[model samples]
Target chain A: EPEVTQTPSHQVTQMGQEVILRCVPISNHLYFYWYRQILGQKVEFLVSFYNNEISEKSEIFDDQFSVERPDGSNFTLKIRSTKLEDSAMYFCASRGGRYNEQFFGPGTRLTVL
Target chain B: TQLLEQSPQFLSIQEGENLTVYCNSSSVFSSLQWYRQEPGEGPVLLVTVVTGGEVKKLKRLTFQFGDARKDSSLHITAAQPGDTGLYLCAEARRGGATNKLIFGTGTLLAVQP
Candidate 1:
């Protein structure tokens, strides 16, 4: 079965540095999303992207966060500055359309020190 | 803000045992989905329930959506070691042009042989 794929399974960055998490959703998917989970916490929604624009975002997705579909196959999440609290497992997901179930990637573990 | 609460956060059971996990929310969802995540991996979609009072069975696992569309349940029968993982319930919010999932805290199940 085709699945969502993410790059840089794990990343370690300085507190003030920027980090870009990349994902390649299923080829035919039209909607993409980014979610994060603090260690031992519930997974939290960050943002949803469709048609090269953001459709929805949570409070956690503040000014520091941005998502881009720079190419037909690549979707990326950029964090302007990392903080200790920003360390978490970030997952990328996609769905074919409005009524389809979202498929998730293996996730990228971001560690800020 | 919509929140999904999962009951019995952690469960440890012997092989061949039966168990059920519950997901409750104050807000109604257009659809509810169940996912399983193993350590160091992203969540894998198990099932999606779109209609109120719908039931879907996947081999030994059975999923049910409440009649009110605000709650759901996952029941596993004769669970084996393979069932050991974190189970999450996610709801797709209503009234959005782009669908995004709000995940529950998750139920961690450890099935030992």
Candidate 2:
């Protein structure tokens, strides 16, 4: 079965540096999303994109965060400035036009120093 | 903001045992999904329940959506050690409503042999 895939399975960055996490959602899926989970915490919504626009975003998705679909298959999340507290696992997901099953990628582990 | 609460934050059981994990919320959702996440991996979709009071089965695993669409349950019968993982419940994002899902804190199940 087709699945979502992400690049840079793990990343380590210093505080105040910028980081970009990349994802390639299921090629046929139309909707895309980004979520994060802190160690021992619940997964929190970050943002969603559809029809070449942002459909929704949570409060946690502040100015420091931005998402882009630069190409047909590439979905990316960029953090302008990193902090120690930003360490977490970031996940990317997508849903196709039918059945509405949301598929998830393996995830990118972000570690801020 | 929509919040999903999962019960029994952690569970440990012997192989061939049975267990149930729950997801509850005050807000109604268009659909609810169950996912399993293993260490170092992102959440993988197990099932999706859209209608109130709907039930679906996947081999030894069963899922039920509450009548109010505000809660869901996952039951595993004769669970084996391979069933061990973090189970998460998430509400589907409605169109124009933050395309992101609201996920529960999660239930970590450890099935030992």
Instruction: State which candidate has the highest TM-score.
Output: 1
| TM-score of predicted chain B, candidate 2 | 0.94
**Clashing pairs in model 2?**
none
Docking category of candidate 1: medium
Tens-digit lDDT string for candidate 2 (A1-113): 89999989999999999999999999878889998989888888788999888898888899999999999989999999998988999999998745577788999999999
Model 1 agreement with the true structure over A1-113: per-residue lDDT tens digits = 89999999999999999999999999998989999988988888899988899999988999999999998999999999999999999999998744588899999999999
Best by lDDT: 1
All candidates: CA RMSD in angstroms? Answer: 1.5, 1.6
Model 1 per-residue lDDT tens digits across residues B1-113: 77899988999999999999999999887889999999889999999899999999999999999999999999999999999999999987642567778889899999999
- Local error of candidate 2 at residue A111 (angstroms): 0.6
